[model samples]
Target: MERSNNTAVTYDSDMQSADLDHLELDSAQKKIGLLRLILCSAIGIFVFFVSVPHNGDTEIVFSIIYNKLVGLMGNFAYWVLVLIIAANFVCHLYYKYIKKGSCQSAFAKVYDNDSVLHTLLYALGLVYVVLYAMKVNIPGFEGPEIIVGAATGESVMPSIVLGVLGIIIVGALFMPFLLNYGILEIIGALLEPLMRPLFKVPGKAALDAVASFVSSSSLGVLITNRLWRKNVYTEKEMVSIMTGFSAVSIGFAYLVINTAGLGHQFVKVYGISFVLVFIMEMIMVRIWPIKKKKNVFYNGHEQTEAERREDTKMSLSLIPKGCTRAVKRAYIAKGVPSEVIASLKDSFLILPQVLTMLSAIGVSGLILANYTPIFKWIGYIFQPLLILFRVPDVAAIAPSLPVGIAEMFLPVLLISGNIGAISVKARAFVTIVSMVQIIFFSETATVMLATKSPIKFREIVICFLERTIIAIPLAAAVIHLFF
Candidate 1:
């Protein structure tokens, strides 16, 4: 989720006798809070019992386990089934601790109020329950086509696994900010000067680059957001900096790409494309040259009342101190209430745009499904572009188009379709494209949120179009010339 411009506020209707605004939990909850640690340890033990083959791909193990089970207990679904069991256990403990003792965290306070994490966990677990309950017949998942391969642990185990994974992921994502204030202070000091000359923008720091490359994009955006709020940057500079890092989260770049179905080539193309995009925007900033009419312009004339209150709470005393304070500040600024608002907005606002994108791609895919015609089309598209780089038509479409989304399983798809056996060139194309991004949709929310620029359909389309114009052909050449 994007960081909110507004400060994080946890409304506390459950105030105590002393009536401190910060509504801490009682002594019992604090003492029993150790249960979360216990649950995590339990999950760790369960993971060991399962003997999960954490081979880069668990398909063989998962599929074989799927074949052996006669009932849900012995079934592959049981692992995920455990998620629901574990979640319930954890939730009970969470509630018990809060009621019994002091709840220290504002995150814990807000978790009590908004129930955002609970909703996601419940929604995810319920998906498994509903799917298995319907238990009709399909080959692998035992569901209808619409719900095909719908990540059935169709058991609670998947849910539990996700819950654990969620804990890991949230910690990883949240930690840098929790721990990196010293780095930021150092970065803001050291990198600001060098940043200007390298990017030709007045001042967005190396911190932006470090954050984008090493951690989450939301964090990099947060840093930029802070600078903007403090009036350290002009309006156009904000746009340039935001665009320079339109992609977010090293998680997708590293974990999902390298560790998942897509392999090394995917990583290379995506890394290169993003690097190019960053470079191009930096170059483009020099070309467009932000003409500032005023000394500065923000989304408004002044920081709003909400912003003022949150800032005061953060700097003065609303936040608790420790290894977690900066994260709490940033997170609270983009807290539960605001997350609810943004998620709702994205669900509604992004629908039509998603439908439009899907529709256009669907039509094109139908025509391009024929290999003979598709190759001809690719030749026509890339021949002229290839001339600019002194290369022949690479005939490799993977790097050139937004195929990441379509061909995530291109290796499997090609193996099934007999495409791999037919031609070396086609195999190369599939490999390269699969290695790159999975189009922008799977990543739509992140991509849209990464930018401070207005993330409307038209603007996104325009930015994507700019990349498509060059990215694909460059990829084709790389594939042809190298692998």
Candidate 2:
């Protein structure tokens, strides 16, 4: 009996061990599956969004696809964007004025302060839709086609749609891989010392700068807002990044250069742009308003610096250290699909706001520039500065300078129209200054205001002036030296 009992016990123990091994195997397979999904998705996003070596001119893979879709869909794609913006208008109107108990909901509270202005803006958006989409002509209020053109144009809407979609695909989908795999942390670790010392910000800020340069500045602010919400960045740091470092992307830089008839001067102009922006960033963060910003994280937590390399022997090898950190991060990252869905939801919520604000400010500002002398009135402030720099056609150039505050591309458009009036050096100066100015209501400023970050309109306006002031002479010097 004892011998029989021992045999049964040993068999049971063996079966239990086999089950444990099988369970581990199953877990390992799941992890591998997830890792593959993340890596493949990341590679696909990078190939599509990031520029690659292509015949002479750089083109993003998705832009080619988007242009084709727009061509195929024709006016349908254009109307679709208009309708989407109109829908946003309707929803905001319902929440602010029509819906039952709308005020009780969190959504309504967001527009409580500016519901009237927003309603008027949305109404104007719908009008512009009619003006541009249907080609409706109204007497006396003869449209400033250039101003409303941006709101209802093929270029801007397609860019906005594709940008949001890119955020969903690249940011939502691939971010886990980038974050989990230790790309960000390792980058943070490598650059922290320099970033913190110069900008008074953490090394992770390098990612924001790169994202802004490669992607859009608005997207950079979105990432900064994300980090701020996650308590990775404090208010001061987030504000510093959003206002100072988030210049237009390389792609947009190319657009401004091409539009301003400075494609020949691309290399020098582009280099001067980003370098001058960085130098001004260091100055901006150390000055007023930005300097007075509260240094507390979103959740009231203090951001502690990453531990020094001396704390761990693995830190001796940068690659191994980064890989180890990435592995740990990837292990804890949220599931891919859920994260992507969350990103999509966030984009949808922000779409109407972006369209409304961008449309309102873009149209009105363009009107002021075209029909009124407000830009000229504002031009006086920049007149002396332009004169000091010896920019040709100072009166013409002065008005163009402040118009960029409305839209970055506006300055380029103005320069392009009057290309014969300004020297090559002045053109180069305008191109770099417009890009580095960075605070345009049509996109960057509007997006920054939408974020929960500590930036205010007053502050943004101040930063715009400061950047323009700082960038001008530096850009002029570069133009004199190189152009």
Candidate 3:
């Protein structure tokens, strides 16, 4: 309802620290990263030789990833063993030499309690493998453990390795698209032209287009917010622009949804989201046409240039690495007592959080797989829903919304397998919905925080309904034409 709009990836891990500047010491997150690296890397390798194809129809491309991890980890069996030492090395460096609130933000935040590495690694979803491998099941989310049990078949190593491959391959495939390119090209060109026509906002199209590429929606939103404040866009423009722009959060739509059995819907979900946004923006432009008022022109949604500048300056100052830290440290370092810095260990919590996430994902995957029949049955009832989207009756499988309850990346997993199960038409339906923005809690939070806007819980619900309404037909078309 407020000014809506959209950037590139900042680490999902770094999000927890948005409000933690008050804390002095860097985080104490360890072990969890190590375990994550091991389980996922190993599982990734397993995916290569076993479930994946030999390039025939290429149902899944397994070995392509397993070999890569073997190279990165040196040995699949101890991927975490190596990753741990590496993570500790970085943490120790931060603990020793780095002085927060005293130096450049990009370089300084590295040592600050919330290191950028945490964000990147956490985004990878490896932590899920470790917790499940250790049989740690989150009380409410028992699904992941069950998935691990099923994935590894009798051996956790096989399942863990397959999972490992899944996480890494997914991470690598779109890393650049997820991160910023500074010169946005392919995707940028594709989505940018719509800005002036749809939202009437203007600036770098590619920069904001990162939202479409990766799972971490927050990163893209932050970038857009910064641009908006720079006066790159008008307030109404920002809102209207994002009408089509704020499809699904890439993280949830890609990483989480696909992980559940509905992984195949990636293209379908994303395609629908894109088409809907484009349509909405065009409609808004036609209806309002950016009309001018008799006196000082304004829409209920517009932010004054001065207000825009002020917000932009504050956000830029806060987000960047150098000045913000200098200012914060100047105040804290002067008289806060050096002893407080020494006791800062209590504040860092990435290791535990990672552990929680990893356990939840693994258990959730296991449970879902164990109850595959239940899902199939659910698919039968949902066949009507698929029918609405023009999904073929023979190609039905319930959408993969369950993995979110336990693991974040489970959505990606679901897309990989079941999408191929249905007719190409059904597959297309699944792919588009899977990619449409929204659904994932992580994605929802990213949009809310980055824009500093008030998007209600119900707003997301409405967004989903609108997107789904538009997507069903598009998916059907893809199936009818291609498959």
TM-score list, all predictions: 0.43, 0.80, 0.40
Query: Which is the leading candidate under TM-score?
Result: 2
Top of the candidates by lDDT? 2
Question: Number of clashing pairs, model 2?
Answer: 3
TM-score of 3: 0.40
Higher-scoring candidate on TM-score, 1 or 2? 2
lDDT of 1: 0.37
Q: Which digits, one per residue and each the tens of the lDDT, describe model 3 over residues 11-41?
A: 2111111122333322222233223333433
What's the lDDT for residue 236 in model 2? 91
Candidates by lDDT, descending order: 2, 3, 1
In TM-score terms, candidate 2 sits at: 0.80
The runs of at least 3 residues in candidate 3 whose Cα sits more than 4 Å from the true structure, single-residue gaps closed, are 1-144, 147-193, 214-222, 225-277, 280-390, 398-421, 437-439, 442-458
Whichever of 1 and 3 has more lDDT, that candidate is: 3
The total number of steric clashes, by the backbone 3 Å criterion, in model 3 comes to 74
